[model samples]
Target: MGSIEDRLRAVEDQLAIADLRGRYCHLLDGRQWPAFIDLFTEDGVFEGLSAVRGRAALTEFFAHRVPAMTEEFWHFCSNGTVVLEGDRASGRISMEYLSVMNGVSYVSAGHYDDEMVKRDGVWRFAARRLTFYFLAPLHEGWAGRPFHNPAA
Candidate 1:
Protein backbone atom coordinates (compact mmCIF):
# COMPACT_ATOMS: atom_id res chain seq x y z
CA MET A 1 0.00 0.00 0.00
CA GLY A 2 1.13 3.53 -0.66
CA SER A 3 1.72 6.00 2.13
CA ILE A 4 -0.65 8.82 3.05
CA GLU A 5 1.43 11.32 1.10
CA ASP A 6 1.21 9.18 -2.04
CA ARG A 7 -2.54 8.81 -1.62
CA LEU A 8 -2.94 12.56 -1.23
CA ARG A 9 -0.94 13.18 -4.36
CA ALA A 10 -3.16 10.77 -6.26
CA VAL A 11 -6.28 12.66 -5.20
CA GLU A 12 -4.72 15.93 -6.29
CA ASP A 13 -3.82 14.45 -9.66
CA GLN A 14 -7.40 13.32 -10.15
CA LEU A 15 -8.70 16.80 -9.44
CA ALA A 16 -6.23 18.34 -11.87
CA ILE A 17 -7.31 15.90 -14.58
CA ALA A 18 -10.95 16.87 -14.08
CA ASP A 19 -10.04 20.54 -14.32
CA LEU A 20 -8.07 19.87 -17.51
CA ARG A 21 -11.08 18.24 -19.19
CA GLY A 22 -13.36 21.10 -18.16
CA ARG A 23 -10.96 23.62 -19.62
CA TYR A 24 -10.98 21.71 -22.91
CA CYS A 25 -14.73 22.09 -23.28
CA HIS A 26 -14.63 25.73 -22.27
CA LEU A 27 -11.83 26.71 -24.62
CA LEU A 28 -13.32 24.81 -27.52
CA ASP A 29 -16.75 26.40 -27.17
CA GLY A 30 -15.37 29.88 -26.52
CA ARG A 31 -13.18 29.50 -29.61
CA GLN A 32 -10.09 30.45 -27.69
CA TRP A 33 -7.82 28.73 -30.17
CA PRO A 34 -4.52 29.88 -28.74
CA ALA A 35 -5.35 28.84 -25.21
CA PHE A 36 -6.90 25.63 -26.46
CA ILE A 37 -3.66 24.65 -28.11
CA ASP A 38 -1.86 25.03 -24.80
CA LEU A 39 -4.16 22.43 -23.25
CA PHE A 40 -2.37 19.61 -24.99
CA THR A 41 1.09 18.21 -24.74
CA GLU A 42 3.52 19.32 -27.42
CA ASP A 43 3.03 16.01 -29.20
CA GLY A 44 -0.57 15.48 -28.28
CA VAL A 45 -3.07 13.98 -30.66
CA PHE A 46 -6.75 14.72 -31.20
CA GLU A 47 -8.45 11.68 -32.66
CA GLY A 48 -11.98 12.00 -33.95
CA LEU A 49 -12.63 10.38 -37.33
CA SER A 50 -9.09 11.46 -38.21
CA ALA A 51 -6.09 12.48 -36.12
CA VAL A 52 -4.64 15.93 -35.67
CA ARG A 53 -1.15 15.70 -34.33
CA GLY A 54 0.74 18.19 -32.12
CA ARG A 55 -0.29 21.52 -30.67
CA ALA A 56 0.34 23.42 -33.88
CA ALA A 57 -1.66 21.03 -36.03
CA LEU A 58 -4.43 20.89 -33.47
CA THR A 59 -4.56 24.67 -33.47
CA GLU A 60 -4.81 24.82 -37.23
CA PHE A 61 -7.39 22.05 -37.20
CA PHE A 62 -9.71 23.76 -34.73
CA ALA A 63 -9.06 27.21 -36.11
CA HIS A 64 -10.70 26.09 -39.30
CA ARG A 65 -13.43 24.08 -37.61
CA VAL A 66 -14.53 25.58 -34.27
CA PRO A 67 -15.38 29.11 -35.30
CA ALA A 68 -18.23 27.98 -37.51
CA MET A 69 -20.10 26.76 -34.43
CA THR A 70 -18.71 29.16 -31.86
CA GLU A 71 -21.87 31.24 -31.73
CA GLU A 72 -24.20 28.31 -32.01
CA PHE A 73 -22.98 25.77 -29.46
CA TRP A 74 -21.09 24.66 -26.39
CA HIS A 75 -20.29 21.38 -24.71
CA PHE A 76 -21.33 20.15 -21.29
CA CYS A 77 -19.24 17.26 -20.04
CA SER A 78 -20.43 15.13 -17.17
CA ASN A 79 -19.64 12.05 -15.09
CA GLY A 80 -15.91 12.00 -15.71
CA THR A 81 -14.34 8.76 -14.59
CA VAL A 82 -10.52 8.84 -14.37
CA VAL A 83 -7.89 6.20 -13.81
CA LEU A 84 -4.49 7.39 -12.71
CA GLU A 85 -1.07 5.80 -12.65
CA GLY A 86 1.69 8.06 -11.40
CA ASP A 87 2.05 10.81 -14.01
CA ARG A 88 -0.20 9.18 -16.61
CA ALA A 89 -3.97 8.85 -16.61
CA SER A 90 -7.00 8.10 -18.75
CA GLY A 91 -10.58 9.35 -18.52
CA ARG A 92 -14.02 9.09 -20.06
CA ILE A 93 -16.63 11.83 -20.06
CA SER A 94 -20.22 12.00 -21.24
CA MET A 95 -20.73 15.10 -23.38
CA GLU A 96 -23.99 16.82 -24.19
CA TYR A 97 -23.33 19.12 -27.11
CA LEU A 98 -26.03 21.77 -27.34
CA SER A 99 -26.56 23.93 -30.34
CA VAL A 100 -29.16 26.43 -31.51
CA MET A 101 -29.92 26.63 -35.20
CA ASN A 102 -32.64 28.87 -36.59
CA GLY A 103 -34.12 29.24 -33.08
CA VAL A 104 -34.27 25.47 -32.69
CA SER A 105 -32.21 23.74 -30.07
CA TYR A 106 -30.43 20.53 -30.95
CA VAL A 107 -28.51 18.19 -28.66
CA SER A 108 -26.07 15.36 -29.24
CA ALA A 109 -24.82 12.68 -26.92
CA GLY A 110 -21.17 11.67 -27.16
CA HIS A 111 -18.08 10.50 -25.35
CA TYR A 112 -14.71 12.18 -24.91
CA ASP A 113 -12.19 9.49 -24.26
CA ASP A 114 -8.80 10.72 -23.14
CA GLU A 115 -5.27 9.64 -22.45
CA MET A 116 -3.32 12.26 -20.52
CA VAL A 117 0.03 12.81 -18.95
CA LYS A 118 1.72 15.18 -16.56
CA ARG A 119 4.54 17.11 -18.18
CA ASP A 120 6.58 19.77 -16.39
CA GLY A 121 4.27 19.25 -13.40
CA VAL A 122 1.16 20.27 -15.36
CA TRP A 123 -1.37 17.78 -16.67
CA ARG A 124 -2.10 17.91 -20.38
CA PHE A 125 -3.79 15.71 -22.91
CA ALA A 126 -1.51 13.28 -24.68
CA ALA A 127 -4.28 11.93 -26.87
CA ARG A 128 -8.03 12.50 -26.96
CA ARG A 129 -10.75 10.60 -28.81
CA LEU A 130 -14.24 11.85 -29.54
CA THR A 131 -17.15 9.58 -30.46
CA PHE A 132 -20.48 11.24 -31.17
CA TYR A 133 -23.64 9.19 -30.91
CA PHE A 134 -26.27 11.29 -32.62
CA LEU A 135 -27.61 14.75 -33.26
CA ALA A 136 -31.31 15.23 -32.62
CA PRO A 137 -33.72 18.09 -32.18
CA LEU A 138 -34.50 18.91 -28.54
CA HIS A 139 -38.00 17.48 -28.69
CA GLU A 140 -36.72 14.19 -30.01
CA GLY A 141 -33.62 13.89 -27.81
CA TRP A 142 -31.62 10.63 -27.80
CA ALA A 143 -34.64 8.32 -27.79
CA GLY A 144 -34.00 7.13 -31.32
CA ARG A 145 -30.21 7.40 -31.13
CA PRO A 146 -29.11 5.97 -27.82
CA PHE A 147 -25.44 5.66 -26.94
CA HIS A 148 -24.45 2.01 -26.63
CA ASN A 149 -20.68 1.66 -26.42
CA PRO A 150 -19.74 -1.01 -23.89
CA ALA A 151 -16.07 -0.05 -24.00
CA ALA A 152 -16.82 3.37 -22.63
Candidate 2:
Protein backbone atom coordinates (compact mmCIF):
# COMPACT_ATOMS: atom_id res chain seq x y z
CA MET A 1 0.00 0.00 0.00
CA GLY A 2 3.02 2.31 0.14
CA SER A 3 4.86 1.94 -3.16
CA ILE A 4 3.27 2.62 -6.57
CA GLU A 5 3.43 -1.06 -7.44
CA ASP A 6 1.69 -1.93 -4.18
CA ARG A 7 -1.05 0.59 -4.88
CA LEU A 8 -1.60 -0.77 -8.35
CA ARG A 9 -1.78 -4.30 -6.98
CA ALA A 10 -4.38 -3.15 -4.49
CA VAL A 11 -6.52 -1.66 -7.26
CA GLU A 12 -6.08 -4.81 -9.27
CA ASP A 13 -7.14 -6.87 -6.31
CA GLN A 14 -10.30 -4.78 -5.96
CA LEU A 15 -11.27 -5.23 -9.57
CA ALA A 16 -10.45 -8.92 -9.50
CA ILE A 17 -12.62 -9.38 -6.46
CA ALA A 18 -15.49 -7.56 -8.15
CA ASP A 19 -14.98 -9.64 -11.23
CA LEU A 20 -15.02 -12.79 -9.13
CA ARG A 21 -18.42 -11.79 -7.77
CA GLY A 22 -19.76 -11.01 -11.20
CA ARG A 23 -18.58 -14.39 -12.41
CA TYR A 24 -20.27 -16.01 -9.45
CA CYS A 25 -23.67 -14.68 -10.51
CA HIS A 26 -23.10 -15.42 -14.16
CA LEU A 27 -21.86 -18.94 -13.58
CA LEU A 28 -24.75 -19.73 -11.30
CA ASP A 29 -27.34 -18.33 -13.68
CA GLY A 30 -25.78 -19.91 -16.74
CA ARG A 31 -25.13 -23.24 -15.02
CA GLN A 32 -21.51 -23.25 -15.93
CA TRP A 33 -20.20 -25.85 -13.50
CA PRO A 34 -16.59 -26.13 -14.56
CA ALA A 35 -15.91 -22.38 -14.41
CA PHE A 36 -18.16 -21.86 -11.42
CA ILE A 37 -16.35 -24.42 -9.27
CA ASP A 38 -13.16 -22.45 -9.76
CA LEU A 39 -14.65 -19.30 -8.20
CA PHE A 40 -14.68 -20.81 -4.73
CA THR A 41 -11.84 -21.64 -2.47
CA GLU A 42 -11.18 -25.36 -1.95
CA ASP A 43 -13.10 -25.05 1.31
CA GLY A 44 -15.56 -22.31 0.45
CA VAL A 45 -18.86 -22.32 2.25
CA PHE A 46 -22.25 -21.00 1.23
CA GLU A 47 -24.63 -20.33 4.10
CA GLY A 48 -27.59 -19.32 1.99
CA LEU A 49 -30.67 -21.48 1.39
CA SER A 50 -28.51 -24.12 3.01
CA ALA A 51 -24.95 -24.58 4.20
CA VAL A 52 -22.60 -26.10 1.66
CA ARG A 53 -18.89 -26.68 1.97
CA GLY A 54 -15.94 -27.36 -0.31
CA ARG A 55 -15.74 -26.77 -4.05
CA ALA A 56 -16.43 -30.41 -4.81
CA ALA A 57 -19.52 -30.54 -2.65
CA LEU A 58 -20.78 -27.24 -4.02
CA THR A 59 -20.34 -28.46 -7.56
CA GLU A 60 -22.18 -31.65 -6.80
CA PHE A 61 -24.93 -29.74 -5.00
CA PHE A 62 -25.61 -27.20 -7.73
CA ALA A 63 -25.30 -29.80 -10.43
CA HIS A 64 -28.29 -31.58 -9.09
CA ARG A 65 -30.34 -28.50 -8.20
CA VAL A 66 -29.70 -25.64 -10.63
CA PRO A 67 -31.10 -27.47 -13.63
CA ALA A 68 -34.38 -27.94 -11.82
CA MET A 69 -34.75 -24.26 -10.97
CA THR A 70 -36.97 -21.95 -12.99
CA GLU A 71 -35.45 -20.69 -16.22
CA GLU A 72 -37.03 -17.28 -15.57
CA PHE A 73 -34.89 -16.76 -12.47
CA TRP A 74 -32.19 -14.13 -12.26
CA HIS A 75 -29.70 -13.04 -9.65
CA PHE A 76 -28.71 -9.39 -9.58
CA CYS A 77 -26.02 -8.15 -7.23
CA SER A 78 -24.91 -4.57 -6.58
CA ASN A 79 -23.68 -2.12 -3.94
CA GLY A 80 -20.57 -4.14 -3.20
CA THR A 81 -18.19 -2.84 -0.55
CA VAL A 82 -14.92 -4.71 -0.11
CA VAL A 83 -12.28 -4.11 2.54
CA LEU A 84 -8.77 -5.27 1.90
CA GLU A 85 -6.92 -7.23 4.58
CA GLY A 86 -3.66 -8.39 3.10
CA ASP A 87 -4.44 -11.87 1.80
CA ARG A 88 -7.96 -11.84 3.23
CA ALA A 89 -10.90 -9.49 2.82
CA SER A 90 -14.52 -9.12 3.86
CA GLY A 91 -17.35 -7.64 1.85
CA ARG A 92 -21.06 -7.04 1.65
CA ILE A 93 -22.89 -7.35 -1.67
CA SER A 94 -26.50 -6.34 -1.96
CA MET A 95 -28.54 -8.56 -4.26
CA GLU A 96 -31.99 -9.34 -5.51
CA TYR A 97 -33.12 -12.82 -6.55
CA LEU A 98 -36.17 -13.21 -8.71
CA SER A 99 -37.74 -16.52 -9.69
CA VAL A 100 -41.08 -17.93 -10.65
CA MET A 101 -42.33 -20.45 -8.14
CA ASN A 102 -45.53 -22.34 -8.91
CA GLY A 103 -46.06 -19.89 -11.73
CA VAL A 104 -45.96 -16.98 -9.25
CA SER A 105 -43.09 -14.55 -9.48
CA TYR A 106 -41.28 -13.87 -6.24
CA VAL A 107 -38.42 -11.53 -5.42
CA SER A 108 -36.01 -11.64 -2.53
CA ALA A 109 -33.73 -8.76 -1.62
CA GLY A 110 -30.63 -9.56 0.38
CA HIS A 111 -26.96 -8.99 1.00
CA TYR A 112 -24.10 -11.43 1.02
CA ASP A 113 -21.65 -11.29 3.90
CA ASP A 114 -18.47 -12.46 2.22
CA GLU A 115 -15.13 -13.65 3.46
CA MET A 116 -12.64 -13.85 0.62
CA VAL A 117 -9.03 -14.89 0.39
CA LYS A 118 -6.32 -14.38 -2.18
CA ARG A 119 -4.97 -17.83 -2.77
CA ASP A 120 -2.09 -18.23 -5.21
CA GLY A 121 -2.67 -14.75 -6.65
CA VAL A 122 -6.32 -15.50 -7.24
CA TRP A 123 -9.27 -14.27 -5.23
CA ARG A 124 -11.93 -16.74 -4.21
CA PHE A 125 -14.83 -16.88 -1.82
CA ALA A 126 -14.06 -18.55 1.51
CA ALA A 127 -17.50 -17.99 2.93
CA ARG A 128 -20.68 -16.24 1.83
CA ARG A 129 -23.78 -15.81 3.96
CA LEU A 130 -26.92 -14.49 2.37
CA THR A 131 -29.09 -12.35 4.61
CA PHE A 132 -32.40 -11.51 3.06
CA TYR A 133 -34.15 -8.26 3.95
CA PHE A 134 -37.42 -9.32 2.45
CA LEU A 135 -39.12 -11.81 0.17
CA ALA A 136 -42.27 -10.70 -1.56
CA PRO A 137 -44.67 -11.93 -4.18
CA LEU A 138 -44.75 -9.69 -7.25
CA HIS A 139 -48.49 -9.30 -6.97
CA GLU A 140 -48.68 -8.36 -3.26
CA GLY A 141 -45.31 -6.72 -2.65
CA TRP A 142 -43.97 -6.48 0.92
CA ALA A 143 -46.73 -4.22 2.21
CA GLY A 144 -48.06 -6.61 4.81
CA ARG A 145 -44.70 -7.99 5.81
CA PRO A 146 -45.36 -11.09 7.86
CA PHE A 147 -41.75 -11.91 8.77
CA HIS A 148 -41.48 -8.70 10.84
CA ASN A 149 -42.24 -8.27 14.49
CA PRO A 150 -43.69 -4.84 15.26
CA ALA A 151 -44.49 -5.89 18.84
CA ALA A 152 -40.94 -6.87 19.62
TM-score, candidate 1, is 0.85
Clashing pairs in 1: none
Stretches > 4 Å off in candidate 2: 66-71, 144-152
Q: Write the per-residue lDDT of candidate 2 for residues 22-99, one digit (tens) a residue.
A: 999998888888898888898999886668999878887777655554545688999999999898999999999887
Compute the lDDT of residue 118 as modeled in candidate 2: 97
Q: Give the top-scoring candidate (TM-score).
A: 2
Q: How much does each candidate deviate from the true structure in C-alpha RMSD?
A: 4.4, 4.2
TM-score of model number 2: 0.88
Residue 11 deviation, candidate 1, in Å? 0.7
Worst 10 residues of 1 by lDDT: 143-152
TM-scores of all models? 0.85, 0.88
